[model samples]
Target: MIKEFREALKRFLVEICEFVQERDISFPQRPSGKYQVEVRDGIPSIQPIGIKPKPDLRALDTLMVGLRAWEKETFGNIMEIITRSERLSQAFLTSATGDLISGNRTMVFPKIRPIIEAYFAETNSFDFQQETFNRICDKVEEELRRLPYCSKILQCPVVGIHVSPNCSDCCLQLESDLQVRSLSLEEIEEFLEYPPFLPSFFTTVVEMKKDMEIFKQQLCFPEKDKKRIECVVIALRLLFGDRIFVPFQIERGQGILGKVLLGEQQSYSLEQRVVPPPRLLHIVDQEKYTELKELYHCISETLLERDRAKIAFSDNRSKQRVELALRKWSEGLDQVSAEWKLIAHWIALEGLFSPSSRQELSFRLALRGAIFMEEKEVYQKLKMSYEMRSRIVHGDYSPDDPQLTEIALTTEEILRRILRKILQQPRNYMPDQLEEKLLETLTK
Candidate 1:
């Protein structure tokens, strides 16, 4: 295997040198000679008097520059792939060179065939055996995680996917069993930002939980360890997608965020003990698994887009556009309600109707889906909520208004249901396209 790998490396190096040589020869020589000016219909055009090879074209320095660029690009690609798995098990990383080398003939070459073909813009020019390639990779994959970091085995991420069906909460759990290994302290700290925890994040408490551990063999786990574990769980949820319900010590506030899983039909909780339940995996019904896969993908994409939108709004340039107003609308979409902010959500949801006027907004929003359209009462309620929005925008309504709470609740629920349905569309849509779809639904 080592010998084969060395030969492949040699071949790669030779090809790289050959590519440079070819490029050096192919560098079209610049048109030579002093410029001669001519007048063409009162416009002056400059032309080269003689065409000759570029004097510096074959210089040693020129060759060196091209070779350096080639090396950087080729080697940079390999390093980029390596960097992606920096948090992977040390054993797997350390063995990467060996694996790549051994698989050079069978695995690496076969896997890279598509890339080579694409670069050449020809597919069948390269012959890669399907069965042989699959077998080679399967073997390596099996051996890849054999020596995972034992002390910290990452478990698959579990997500409580936010769902609303028939205008009711229909949230379900989606557990994807996958794991990652040790990252640097800085990296782990960065991960803590994902959970609902404020000031400090879940993964950030991991070390504190470890310090609380007692017993020689680390048998006795502290009571507070559950929160720390939940922090990791929550971070997993963020890295993946979906709501994660991690039990926190009573001292920590709010078990759920924004009423997530507030009225779940089947809530699963793990006991806080040294040895809790072996696992609480959420298995989708075989019949519904296909839909769950698509739903999960939708949820993941929407959350990612939301994060990007948040980051964009943070930029001062974005704030100067009409988007500044839209940003306010989006803020209320996911933001935890505050006394002063309640009315904003009411106005925000109304704008999703892509209204030509205040009057048309309610009808358009209602027409968006059966959740509101089919429920005539829901449609009326939505219209009423928009009227409340008018009061706030017109300075007639206050957060302290007695009816504000009910109106706020109605708007928030509608926003969640409507947004969830929009996200679940078979294909992804940007905000404008989504608005178009809302109108298209009414016509259809």
Candidate 2:
């Protein structure tokens, strides 16, 4: 029965933590009760009172009296009750027992004895002791389990080494979101200190509270409104030790599509004349137009080499040789600032941006404008191909907005088409190719 009592006492301590955790309360910082501690034959019993004054010693005294009566009605005098219900104060004393037999002295093993033997001597009866002892032990164990565990460290065995769940839930959520496959122990430790997951667990709780405020406004009627909100509140309470008040603010959704469309409007109205001018043809005079015309012809004639080679005209004009010289002379005109302006003005005046309508929402409109204004439909198709390339340069239009996705995809297609055209012999083999061919001819 004594053995059973000892085991019960140990379990009693363990149960304190369990009880405290269930109630979401903590154990007192210091020991309490007149029986601040207690002891059995060779073991100690400790009772924790969380941040409270000593418990009623009257209850402990009643228990000790009952224990004493049980001992007296059973094994009697050897049992002494210190009267303190606090388990940790139960101090056990062990002493060596000596025996003398047949004129010889021998030392026996240490025998545990009550340090207060005088108090135990007053007890008298000897009966069925073990049962009585068990009764007293059961009472003590019950009382001990009602107390809180003195330290969080003691609760470690019950819950794993993880920090409070409230604190860890955010990272746990983020990891799941980012599809982080696995994190080594070292990675977890580092993440505990870094952004997106860093800061004390309490900080996360406060942040979650703030998020809740935002959600309250954004999700006016969430599916599990109360439960979801309460979960966040409770998590915050556990994560951060704070009295929190969260505020809600609406987020604005202004985007590139809207901006670009407005820009197109402004462009046609010439409202943003102060902003940088669009990168398009800007030619003004007839001379510049003529120069641009000749340059385009020179460039196109050189590209029509296969057709030129097939034709056998023994004319003294030597059109091929003359055209070659014209192409070289036109190349200089292509670089002239005046010709570039003509092309720019022609593009701007092409009615791509309807004066009465909003500006284009995307670079596609810009590309389409350049295409329409160019002299040839072939040039229009060639310029149209580059829309996607320009769109990519613009980057993502807006956060959490899918409108740009279709535009981006279309832009990509235009770029691919333009790239294919650029790779064609005419667009691909440029003046650079001509210069190399001419150099070869001169060397020959």
Candidate 3:
């Protein structure tokens, strides 16, 4: 397989070199326009006045055809092996190829043109191309061998957290594999270079560039390993009692020409208007960092057990109910509105506590939850929150109502506690066992 791949790579490089030679001969000689860099409010943008003759793309088309044939004949088998080992879908390679050919900001061929041009500067020797091809093959083989063991690192922009400056790297190592670290100078400079367009004339590009500094810290984790990390984020929100979240993430270590690949920004409802600003950045010292790590483990362990249960009993009703409840909880975290969040949380609670029927839902929910938690006040709190839930759903409550905020917070805490308890010993909280425990409590 390696020998075949090396041969194909050599052929591809030879074709690329020939195409470059041919394209340069056919290139237009006359200058069509002068390009200038214009700085507006401290943002530099290229301004081109006249139309330049288009480069002959026929050579590029021929090279692409050869590349496609190589992919089908040789790379396809290697990709299959990788897919099986990585548990990636069939579309993974296709998506990667699409990104290489038609990425928004950069394309692979154009970016590599400079390096190729430098290689052929002195002489277009076949021996030099062969040396280049051999060097590339060596690197490609090494990469293929390491690919399965390697994982993509995703740097998610985290709001409402900062690392203490006294720390060595300004990073908090949450786990061996996960960390909260300040963005590197390269990443910050990249942000400044490509500032988002102003939403209005009122917001200047310079002001937007200043706002980019708000992203001081990021949550770093393996892209494919986000399940536990996601639980950790939720745990952080629960611990801080604030809207600490990841708005967007960028995949690192896959840059072309010093430009990193940008991930999609999360869409928000109209009510959100804009991504919520950082409230108060909490500096994470050692003690607080330890606390954060421990809470993350607690939450992640529960989720891990739930996943195990699902795998063990794929069609188990109890497992299915727990899955639904967990989904609702995650959806609640995604919601920007307190009302929607409260509703989503209540639905999750229903999946956990009221799996069978909605008969006497309020009473059963409050009683079962309170007894399970071993707190009498929980019963009253849940009962009141259930009433508020009814009012919100019925469209009788005002969004500005002070009780809305209070109930949202209270219900979130209650639900978080309940989930943690149930997840700690999922078998004990299965529907039948839970009902038995509630009956025993009532009898007592």
Per-model C-alpha RMSD:
23.6, 30.4, 15.1
lDDT digits (tens) for residues 225-256 of candidate 2: 22232223222222221222112111111121
lDDT of 3: 0.52
Off by over 4 Å in 1: 1-295, 303-351, 356-359, 366-372, 423-444
Report the error of model 2 at residue 295, Å. 66
Cα misplacement distance, residue 226 of candidate 1 (Å): 22
Please, what is the TM-score per model?
Answer: 0.31, 0.18, 0.56
Per-residue error (Å), model 1, residue 133? 36
**lDDT tens readout by residue for model 3, 130-227:** 54435534444543343222123445556666666676567766666567776666655654343333221110000000011111122233333656
Cα deviation of 423, candidate 3, in Å: 4.2
lDDT of 1 by residue, 1-444 (tens): 433422332343234335334333222223443323233443322233465223332322421242344333332332222233233212121232333222222332322322221222111111223433233233333332232211211221222321223211232333332112223467445344333433212221122211111011112234443333443442333222222333332211111110111111111233232212112223223334345444444443233232422122223332232232233333443344433345665444544444445556656655543243345576677777767766777888666677777776666555555544443442232333445655676799
Q: Residue 165 in model 1: shift from native, Å?
A: 25
TM-score ranking from best to worst? 3, 1, 2
Highest lDDT, which number?
Answer: 3
- For residue 324, give model 3's deviation from the true position in Å: 3.7
